[model samples]
Target: MSRLWSPHIESMKREQIEEMQTELLKKQLNYVYHRAPFYQKLYKKSGVKPDDVKNINDLQKLPLTKTGDLQAEMKETGDEYSGRLCVPESELLAVYGPNQHPMPENPLITGITDSDRNTIIQHLARNLIMSGIYSGDTIQSLCWAWEPFNRVYMAANLLISPSVSEILGITPVTLEIIPLEAPRTFATARLLKPSLIIADIGHLTQLAAICQQNNISPEEIGYKTIILKEQRILSEKETKEVSEKWKAKVHNMLAVQDNMLYAEDCNIHNGLHIWEDAFIPEIVDEETGEKVGEGEAGKLAITNLFAKGNPMIRYLINITAKIEKTPCNCGRTHSRLKPQ
Candidate 1:
């Protein structure tokens, strides 16, 4: 089953994406400049105002913020994001964190307040739906190196609603190993021979080896959709070699737990298709803090419109990407993402 929005998003052209960004730029700027103190101070110092910023190009008037700014705020105020939270902490949802850097260094958390938790759950549920995953689809698991973590909880909750409560602390080993007799819990899905195998690329290679050594072809074992991260468990060169060696085109996806949602697909092998409606994204030189010209490589910065809990403007996401003015081969007007 093909995803409903994939075709539309993947085919979107460049002007369309920019047009969408222009439409939302004002609201996004306002959400941050007025509500976020950090942004307000920066805007004031730079002599930029949210109302004066009309289009995406006008964004250059604003100053760029780095992770150090956030660290500084946290060190001084003990709250990390002093100007970020437009709403009370009680209204926030879960914070997703500690992915880019080590757990000790870069940490992030989301606030779960009111129905936002339910909203996030439903949003992810829809995303899985868009990705062609569904209930009763046998799912083999990975990405669980740690217990009592958020990813495990999120995967389970997004896929299984009622029993999401039960998915906590489930061992990754237990999920990887098959049972001889009838298995209960998610074990049943595995025993039933799942339709999907969710593992990083390296794990997939290892699992393929294990199955082959055991004289099992993926077809014989009912292995169908294997979700491997497009980036890689091995080096990029090695991953490409494996793809050629196996004659497989491993699908790539953008899975941001917070700050962004996986609502769009990629075109032209850029990164994920960002929801320009959800965020106003800018690319700039990490060292120089100046805008990188279109198709030029730079760090990825984000200013989200709906983020009331943490109203960050020009928040440095530490990503390097290039802009494309050309339309994608797919066919729509949305600018596709390309991440390095």
Candidate 2:
């Protein structure tokens, strides 16, 4: 049977998904327009108000926010957050940026309130469950530690590891993957005998080579699943090669760093299912900024519907992908993104 963290939301009907998205989008737009100076200026300049967006379809009326726009705003205003921060400095719980260590001059800093952090954790838990994590399963995470560089990567340790341990009764072994620490990592893996491994393809590739050199087999390690922290789609050959080498089910996890968005592949491995309830995704033509048809490849744009701090509206993420609205074999009703 398919594992689900929030079955009702994950398997909701298309109509119900749309209704929830519409309600959340309207509230998010209103919240950003009134509280965030950057969004307020952008909407007023485009002659569109929050009320103009009556539903999800009406979101096209608002202008798109690009990375360049955010940079320009930061350059002009000298604000690190580019005026996208809705919460005050005191209310900010966590702040993330593009680099490992964000400087004061960084243009794209995202701050999250306590509520926003909880929302991220909730969705992240659902994604882990869908990726075949079960209670009592031990997870060995090779992602980065809880640092300022990438919140999603850090979530693998700080948020996901603890949450899964406390709530789902899973044991987590998180290790920061440094080149010199390869021996240590493998030694710990052998000792712990974790059921699942979470790491990027590069790390896995290196580990695989090391295993071969040491006359060790991945199958002997007894990990049943390997979750790849991938930003782009992997070719069929690559996926097959990795799965064969590791003798484990390989799952792709697409993490959009800018918006803190995550989409994970289920057991079927057809595509990465996006958590649409928290994010509004639009596949639009890069040149004309027009919406693309179903299953048509275009730039992936996302709007944060549940984030209370640094909410993004129609932010073009600069990734080409085709959005699939059909139901997944795993019974999830959320749309999937086949990233190109």
Q: Name the best candidate (by TM-score).
A: 2
**Most accurate candidate by lDDT:** 2
| Clash totals for all candidate models | 23, 0
Task: List, residue by residue over 87-201, the lDDT tens digit for candidate 2.
Answer: 8888887776663343445448888777776676677678778777887888887755543223432234454333435566677777776565566668888888898887777
TM-score of predicted model 2? 0.91
TM-scores of all candidate predictions against the true structure: 0.70, 0.91
RMSD of each: 6.2, 2.9
lDDT of 1 by residue, 52-80 (tens): 87777877777777667666766666764
Question: All candidates' lDDT scores?
Answer: 0.51, 0.78
The runs of at least 3 residues in candidate 1 whose Cα sits more than 4 Å from the true structure, single-residue gaps closed, are: 1-3, 6-17, 80-82, 100-102, 112-136, 140-190, 202-222, 229-249, 261-271
